[model samples]
Target: MAIYSAERRRLMEMLHPGRHQVFSEVLSSLGAFMEKEILPLSPKLDAGEASIAKPRKALFEQGMTAIPFPVQYGGLGLPFSVYAMAVEMLGNADASVALSVEIHNAVAEGLLRYGSDGQRKKHLAAVISGKTLASFGLTEPASGSDSSTMATTAEKKGGEYVINGSKMFITNAGEASLYMVFAKTAKGPSCFLVEAPNPGLKFGKDLKKLGMRGSKTSEVIFDGCRVPEGSLVGQEGEGGEYAKEILHGARIVVAALNVGISQIAYDKSIAYAKSRKAFGKPISEFQLIREKIADMKTGIDAGRLMYLYAARIKEMGGDYTSEASQAKVYATEMSLKACDEAIQIHGGYGYTTDDLHRHWRDARLLTIGEGTSEVLRMLISRKELSRAQ
Candidate 1:
């Protein structure tokens, strides 16, 4: 049985109209790739170094990089709707891989929006081809949601700028070839492209996390790391604005990922309920079990619709900060709830180190990363109050 019903299909169609065919095709391709390649590689990557390198290399070898960039940059130039669908499908199979891919795309989008023409020509093509991995360095040990208070400083000295600070919980930190680091400059907060292998650039060991184990998250330290003056991205003092633009779009993508995870959890719970019998009958036949299923399905459907709406608003060139915040907050919380219920439905089996348990653990990270639920609530409230004023 298909998880997406006809009504859901019609809803998506109504929202996207002529865009559905391309979106469906990208989703189908991503679904097949995730099942055949990404999911199978997750266990190996989670195992150790040697095993991890193979899939990481294979992801580049395959055409997965085309999902985000424009055709001029050797990408599929796929619509944001298609990109969201592809990410949702990938997240359903392996969130770690999905996360790694998502960060790379986010960085690419940021560069496209803020990078100079020379910077784009020099960097974007390599990124789209997966020859270069980029990390966004915005969140710090001291600056998670409150970016204005970041302590990272960049000082211009003649023809170069020296950077000094540390970034915590950075995705692809050790593995990335380049980093889009934000630091307080004389003009204000500015972004600079810092290349790896620099003597002053250092990476701390990966922080052991509760979930998303296969993805590398580490701390980056810049001790007087210097880059050419030309490395600055966009206008000086606009780094925060640039970061916000990147994140507004990214929040929706994260929402799509959460929707995918929630759907998977719901499916697993439903299957377990049908197969596990109690009192000489399937647990799915019980009223309480049916109610759990109903709630899970309803939450997933609502979250999915919110994700699509946010994406549509973005594609239409609308200001969707409030909409994106709502989608991300709702979808992530819904996923957490669904995962908890899935674990409950699985009884003792879910508590073990099984796939369902892994899903539950992975689902926890979505709420905290990107932006915390508390922070998102504040953003939504602030926007509403501003509009009222």
Candidate 2:
């Protein structure tokens, strides 16, 4: 089955109506590529039979990471919505690969937003062009959702800054060529671009995960790790805001990713409901089964529109934190619900089949990864309340 659906095309048309020709061409090409190359790898990625690097690298070569970046940085210079939709397709193709690629692109997004000229010239093009792999290193073992309370520290020592403490649950940990790490300085929290192969940097073994098994997640240890003074992306003490901004954009992409998972699960449920017979008739004819299909489709549409709206706001240079949070919270939960309903519709086969149930496993991580649903709800509420005042 095609990963990109008619509904997805219609949604794109809704965004620009008759002017979505460029978007259509790019999306159709990407969808076709994913259907052939990435979709077949989903089960193997979950089962650990294949490594995440090769397919991810192939996608990067497809300019997936470069979509929303500036053309000077070897990007396609497309809008953020294009990138978000691409991510949705990727999620349907293979959630593990999508997770890894999105984390890698997050680093690129940070550099584009906050890095200096030399930093951008040196690392930005390489990162977006797939010459180097980057990983986000903001969360720590001591600090989960509360990023401001992170324990990692960076002390200036002449021309270099010495970094200590560790980052936990870091995606692409061992494999990343560059690490976009956050640490506390005497002034305040700061962002630094730390290169790999440093003597002081070490990574813990890849953590066995509940899902997104293809991507490596581990503890990144910084024992007096040092980077040149130029490694600082933006001014010191401002990293907190930078981190927040980066995450806001990432939340939209995360929402898109979950929507992709829901689409696949919904598609599978539909096909199954038609093919699987009960009481000498297809389950699709049953009122209860039809209700499940309707609910799944509705949730998928709502989740897709939420992310797209958030992405559009972001592209317009508006404050999208509230919208981003709302999209993330809703889409992640929506994905979980859609996957669960799929399993229910599939009866015993969904419970037993690895391929069918893996959608739930993959969707489970997004609720806790970028931002917890509970925290996002609070953020949305706080923003709304502040606006009301």
Candidate 3:
């Protein structure tokens, strides 16, 4: 069965029945492409036997990166929910690719929201169209999720801004052709569109990771990386705000991605339960096994609905920050639980198998990445309290 066949239909029916056929057609085609091209590469990607470049390029050619943007920038002009669903499918196929593509789209989003007309003309189209790949540079060694404490600095020199400091754990670090770099200026936090191959820009070796190894992660160092004044995105000192807004949307997508991971893990567990025999019958017949299966499916459904709810709010142009955080917190933790139950249901095989455990591994990152669950809880509470007041 297709990944988006059943639940996706329900989501589209609830959120956008009028466009259901269009979404089904486009996503079905994309899902077919993923099953053919990306799924086969997942094992190789996990084993370090294949580079992610070819499959990533293939996905880009299929216009996965341009799904939610406006038509003027070569996007499909689809609703954000469609894009969220697409990310879920990608996560089902391969988490690393989903992470890379998600971060890339976030950069496109940043440009759309904050870039000047010239910057948009120069970079946004290329990025969404996948003519150029971009990475976000905000997190630093000392600053994990807290952007206010970032130590990176940019100084005005004549007409150029000279940036200094490093970004840690940057996704697509070495491979990206452009970076949306954030740094402190005399005014405050700022954003710069730094293109690749600058004399002052350098990337550290790719870090060996416990999961999502298919995507590149490294330190991005800026030794006085210089860019023209025009490279600045939005107003100076507003990069922090831009980053927050960008991340709110990203949290929704991250939630979708985790739901995808949970779906895959749940599917695998169900198949395993039906096939693997215990006590002369399929283990799925056991009461405990059935309970785990029920919880896994329920959690996956709840996570999917939560993210889609956040996406709907975003589509309607409402304040979705708290909703986004709630989805991220719930879905990420829910995925971890589902994957763990999947591993438990598989028993010894799950503990030893890379394919089974990798789902858990990949799901593990999101809880810590976008916004840590603890932090998101606080943010959500603060929003609710302020709204009540």
TM-scores for every predicted model = 0.94, 0.98, 0.99
lDDT of 2: 0.92
Find the 10 residues in a row with the least total lDDT in model 1.
1-10
Q: Residue 135 CA error for candidate 1 (Å)?
A: 0.7
Candidate 2 stretches greater than 4 Å from native: none
Q: Which RMSD values do the candidates have, in order?
A: 2.2, 0.9, 0.8
- Clash count of each predicted structure: 0, 0, 0
Candidate 3 local accuracy as lDDT? 0.93
User: Local error of candidate 2 at 206, Å?
Assistant: 0.6
**Cα lDDT of model 1 by residue, 297-376, tens digit:** 99988988888888878888888899899999999999999999999899889797457877777889998888899999
Better of 1 and 3 by lDDT: 3
lDDT for residue 70 in candidate 1, whole number 0-100: 81
* Candidate 2 TM-score, C-alpha based: 0.98
Relative to the unseen true structure, what is the C-alpha lDDT of residue 319 in candidate 1, on a scale of 0 to 100? Answer: 82
Clashing pairs in 2: none
Q: Model-by-model lDDT, in order?
A: 0.82, 0.92, 0.93
